[model samples]
Target: MFKVYATTPESMGPCGIAAHAARAEAMGFDGLHVPDAIHDGLLLAALALQATRRLRVGTSVLVAFPRSPMTVAVAAWDLQQLSGGRFELGLGTQIKQNIEQRYSARWDSPVPQLREYVQSLRAIFDSFQHGTPLRFEGEHYRFTRLQPFFNPGPIAHPDIPLLCGAVGPAMTRMVGRIADGMITHPTNTPPEYLRTVCLPRLRDGLERAGRDPAALRLILGPLVATGVDEQAVAQQWEQQRRLLGFLYSTPAYWPSLELFGWQARGAELQALTREGRWQDLPAVVTDEMLSAFVPRGSYAEIAEVLRARYAGLADSITFPMPQDTAQDTQAAAAIARLRA
Candidate 1:
């Protein structure tokens, strides 16, 4: 069965998390996914978990640099226990500025750092399950004596499915090797790029690790904006286009867009930033740009587009909530069409 999920908008504040999760469950969505941004994804996940019974909750990604692996592992374990084992841990290495300036952490050798992070998480879980002493010495993390007092004890499934948020080849491959699934960025990657570039790298990683690629779950979060009014839909599309333009302009996000035949536009977007043309972003962003970056239409039309876009690859589809619509009614209508 294809699973549908929802995200609370970045501007919606944390109070919307429980409200959205409740609507998602009541509307028959399979899961609730929260993006890891300046906001707290785990806190949102906890709220969602408490609000719904059957809906699985997870972060689209929690950046690796902001918090230590041991700390994340403990929190994840506690969430799993509290949520009755319905929590999935999604992790990523965010760009340099967010890591260094915002989080006050060093950003170096992300691939290696991520590998060590995953290893440490697994090691901590293993120690809890088997009552064995845990010892791991990695470039990014080291743990020698894991006190029993800090341990949350074993979950029903001690091995929580780890999902990596990946866009490039190295991270894609790493996901197949170590993660149970992957969460892809919608604005940066097209479906064709995912099939031709990202998926192949993932398969290669699974092959190298002696794992079956077919067994892995692929989760996609397609940025979507739906409204009952056509004019409102157009305005929402423009807003999303400007937002994506701002993101693609960043050097850290350019690689993903470049992979999908948008290098020149990516460079232009970046140039706009260099010139401090922030106000002119909407002018540079065309209707074509908005359509390519996000699915936008009336609720029914958007649902159909999403169903088609995610037809085969996505085991779960997460749509970022429409900026112009009422969350509860829009969610109910979209879920009705998606499940139909």
Candidate 2:
């Protein structure tokens, strides 16, 4: 999971990110996923690579609409080469509002647009490795020029895996066809959602691409709120409820709410957010809604709960950090149990 708490513009320079990465790696996280909200995801990926020795690093998503495919390929290639093949390139088509308003970028046909984006990156990487002239022209992206001076030219690790952050079926299928892995939106995914909605779509995508089912990884991160005791669990749930409310405020992320027949609640939250009523948003998410998404238990039981819920389903689950030094020891024990 991302250390997004420390990822502010002031603090997330090389030193700050390196410290967080070192701490996370020391805690035995297998990978660091950089998020794309306040900070640049690609830049965070680079910093993570520079900071850690053994841990893998990737973007939860680098927004696809703002950056060209060639630019992405260049950065990912350098990170892969520098990190000795431990870089994963994860992309996403962010919501239309963010694309149009936040970035001043155009947004249309995200599914097909992202498909061509991934294709273009692959084509560019291929040209760099094989010395072939880059010639990929799709409806959304065109890359027909690559001078020798521009190409980074054949690193030790050319096959950097491309992962996509997706919630919808069309995007999931596109990921299965072209991407190496898929990151599920935590708000839209629970264990039941994975078994029913996510896995089937992934299978269909793999079948459509004529690829092996085992080739793609199903990455999931349930909202895990683990604590040492009852009081801590209560506090964690409160925190998670606020986060859930914020996510449900986005209409694009209403699938899980829809599943619970709380789409109306989501609409109400959206209206509150539009009126700049951020303080009132958390009230819209009921305790029942919070329980439906987040898994709350003691630190000792959380790993087993996750394994039982997602065994044979998720290739990797996001590692939740313990609150204190005492819980950290317990958390490590839990991680060992999951590995076993």
- Estimated TM-score per prediction? 0.92, 0.93
User: Across residues 236-335, which tens digit of lDDT does each residue of candidate 1 receive?
Assistant: 7776777887877776666656655567877787788889988766666666666666877787587788777667766777765544345557656777
Span of ten consecutive residues with least summed lDDT in model 1? 319-328
lDDT of 2 by residue, 1-340 (tens): 2211111222355545676666667766777777777777777778888888987887877898999888889889999999999898878998998899999997989999999998999899999999999999888889898889998898998999888988887888888887899888878567777777778888889998899988987677567777887788889889888888888898888887777688999899999989999999888889888777888878678777777777777778776666465666777666666666
C-alpha RMSD of each candidate structure in angstroms: 2.1, 3.0
The runs of at least 3 residues in candidate 2 whose Cα sits more than 4 Å from the true structure, single-residue gaps closed, are 1-14, 323-327
Please list the residue runs of candidate 1 whose C-alpha ends up more than 4 Å from where it truly belongs after superposition: 259-261, 322-330
**Model 1 root mean square deviation, Cα atoms:** 2.1
CA lDDT, every model vs. true structure:
0.77, 0.79
Rate residue 87 of model 1 by lDDT: 93
The clash numbers for all candidates, in the given order, read 0, 0
